[model samples]
Target chain A: MTVQQNVAQATPTINLPTINLQGNHACALGAVAAGCRFYAGYPITPSSEVAERLAKELPKVGGVFLQMEDEIASIAATLGASMGGVKAMTATSGPGFSLKQENLGYGMKAEIPCVVVNVMRGGPSTGMPTRPAQGDLMQARWGTHGDHPVVALTPGSVEEIYQQTARAFALSEKLRIPVIVLFDESLGHLEETITLPDVTEYENTIRKWATGKPEDYKPYKADADGVPPMARPGDGYRVHTTGLIVAEGGFPTQKADVVAPVMKRLLDKIEINNDLVESFEDIDCQDAEVVVVALGIVGRSAKKAVRELRQQGIKAGLFRPITLWPFPTKSFRALTKKAKYFVVAEMNAGQLILEIGAAKVDKQSVSGLNRYDGEPISPSLIKQAVKEVLGHE
Target chain B: MTTSNKKNLEMRFSGAGGQGLQLCAKIFSKALIGEGYHVSMSQSYEPTSRGGLSRADIVASGDTPDYPLTTELDVLLILDQAAVNASEGIIRDDATVIIDPRRTKNPPQGNFKVIALPLSETAIKLGSERITNVVATGVIAALSHDIPLDIVEGALKSISPKKFLALNMDALHAGVELARGLKTA
Candidate 1:
């Protein structure tokens, strides 16, 4: 890593307000700031600290925290609590994320507004408990069975963890679907400075539970936004929860007509609002010949690597997806005219590259720069990758 | 190195895992932030407890960083022998490495100047088994030549528990003397 060769003391200013913070604390502060009132999760590495912090901190803010027996039960409890009329969340890593998949599908099926925080560990199955991995990009998007709505946000920094975890909850409640805050194990365990925001700058989502006239209220009845009017259990409303297709009353029904609109509402909310759902970062690609697409810790490396390449006057730029699941296709795809070559760098064997490939039409120019040994891709390695794939190496 | 009236400075405490590196990083960063430096400290370590490497890159810069990536090393404090090898390759040539000479297997060899302080052994001399980091922080503060004595003292003041305050203060000052005694060879 040639420090003097690149990145002179430029863009000097207050960087972001340094405050020593552990990643777990960042997760807690993010969720709390984002309007999370309920947390239900089991303890696990890189992720346990999140739960541990929330256990100690949530009660002070009038929020409820529960330690469930297992990951499945933890998510289920969070789902139930969210529907009971408050913003809810759960945190976990690899094996636990796998356990929560069926229930995650249940969240989509039942349209429960809750946040699931998956601090990814290296895995096929419990591969590395503490090291980071961007391996769960596909899983966060399609881990659950069937067609389901998703709102997944990834934070590259500790500050982003605080900001995005809050956004995750707001997104879940606003869209009335399960939202996932995805951070690699690296980001989860890494500590850094985090500022507790001025409270007023952030907006939080407050779940509106059914009040008055339970008889007329339909739990699944769609409003103008296509989200069902949700009310909690014991709210004197006939609120029923289902994993099966059901009518607005919350009862399971075999009627095909009932299933279509339910599925439609589930999918449409995310689809119609795709523009609002995806988040990204773009640097110096205005007229670049090559664009490097990466996220998480790799995104940080890519940024430094691009800075190096640019110093050599190689016209390199970085495009990081803040929202990994929905894959910011619109923002990235729009740059095809200016970006003739796209180097997709990730810590996986082309998981995110597959999405980038699908989102591009110029197949010849779209290629992958991948690594999956759980070690982070360095700037030098990425620079070499950028040069090799684009014929500069 | 010259200061232009800036009261805050962020430095990174790096070493391999389980040498109490995270605790060391946290104590310093927390101490700095407590002294109002707006500190950002983070550690990245391999998952395993034994033989796995651990690194804490605690940044206590005066200005906040947009991202928590630290490239500038004012003082690179190291404990593990492997850490000396790792830091030697990457850290800035101008940066100072405060080493516990007793622990280093392959001491940094180059034109680079090193302030060798037996911080850990000194902590052992102070009757506690785990104040080498505190003593090292003192050494780093003294050798920093860039940071002020009051700021380092204030950081130590902010972090030490009330009962052990005087002892730590002595250890810290001891490190300063040790740093002053080192001659560039």
Candidate 2:
């Protein structure tokens, strides 16, 4: 907080081309760039900067920013705003992320498009507010109850945080599902200099609004893509949304036939379009015999380890999934074709590694290098893991 | 682990909380990035509002930094004895150590290059001890060509408040002069 502000220059649009910024600030600015017009959240450590920055910047762009009483109301307000035809978002850390789960399921069930940025910290319950952890990886995918699909993106750097936030918005809007931008405490607080590309560099997607006659519109009706065209309230079209099973006419239905397709479409919207939602980074992986699978800040360290192993004449590589959910199983399977050994490095106790093993990538060859401590996984530890997995000289 | 062939400079600025160590690291990092280098900074602080240990580790390189954390420190600037103790086993043999001799009565015996500067006293002489971090940052800019003094001045000008701009600039110049006067031998 003692860091002085930049000189009194006119506050340009939050999307400045070049700046030194924290990862949390980058998410807020990226939200603005992606045409996000509403933000609602209860402040929490590591993730609070996004809410704090958006509270100030959103108003300047003719948007709405609200500080809700709790994480529950925060996500509820975000869902409400998104239903009202605006790109909306809410951010919170571990405990708050847990509190928002029920509403997150509500957003998913109702097919509301919004973003939830979870800056992760150590937690079973208020464990370590200031330290970094990937404890929420599995929680993010399965936190909310029931069977529903969601997209979650993990960023390793401030610049990637910015771009991934914009992508989260685009994906959420396109898929009509709440997208989670996962951030570890280390990444959320990291400060770095980066050059943001021009707005033309990334495409932005907005939800399709019903263009049919008001009387002919069905709020829950699906188009060819299996996503319903949304019509905001007061738009002369029926706009009923509920957590209960809903019919295509936007009315609650008890019939099994009506409820089954509705639930099916909710999952199909993301699962069927998995190719569009999945994103992963392959570093020195083409000819690698040893592959280290990592995510978020741990992935950055894995990249360094891979570079070091390569210098030692060991064919090591890094597989980092930018999108955590949907698990990017196809990419891991692709790597298994060439890899002789797999070293899974994560800040959690074998969360994503289990998923890699679930992909059937030779369980005998996959080694779990787990860390649940509050500290980050160092590149040296990862290199040591690689050496152990490969039994190299 | 085998090290890479990349030549990158890694530095840490440590002090008790409220010493403005994070701000000093940020100013130096921004200046290096302005000179067209890739820079990443990571800082760890006490969970409380203030008064515990605070440190900011920075990695700056011509190429993008693959590992953003300070795996090995090339230079360390400590403001107090606690910082000196905190850095006991981490300081590399060839690294440079710049310390304020008033707070740290005895510098550690090591193969690293050590330069003693009374940064707090110098800042107090200029106007206030709050600018000691700025004074230390000035010494860092002068010690290496990686961060030019002009760029640091420019960075400080933009980030420092108008109320302390003059004093902070003076503190920075004083730091540069202090470092310039020192001889390695």
True contacts kept of each: 0.42, 0.70
Worst 10 residues of 1 chain A by lDDT: A1-10
Q: How close is candidate 2 to the true structure, as a TM-score?
A: 0.91
Regions of model 1 farther than 4 Å from truth: A1-18, A198-204, A207-216, A254-258, B1-18, B27-39, B46-52, B60-67, B70-74, B108-111, B183-185
- Indicate the DockQ of the complex predicted as candidate 2: 0.64
C-alpha TM-scores of all predictions: 0.87, 0.91
RMSD of each: 5.2, 5.9
Candidate 2 residue-wise lDDT, B35-143, digit = tens: 8767788887767787767889888876657778888788999897767776776688988899999887878778888888989999999989999999998899898
Give the alpha-carbon lDDT of every model: 0.74, 0.84
Per-residue lDDT of model 1, residues B95-185, tens digit only: 6767777877667775556766678888899987477777887777777655577777876777678998998888888888777787442
Give model 1's TM-score versus the native structure: 0.87
Position A7, candidate 2: lDDT: 14
What digit string (tens of lDDT, one per residue) describes model 2 on residues A1-393? 011111111223556567778899999988998889999999999799999999999999999999999999999999999988889999999999999999999998889999999999988899888889999998999999999878899987888898888878888888899999998999999987776633332235788888869999988888878898888677788677789888889888889887788888878887777777888888766577888889889988998888888888888888888888878787667755778778889888879877877885554488988888787888989999888877763
TM-score of chain A of 1: 0.91
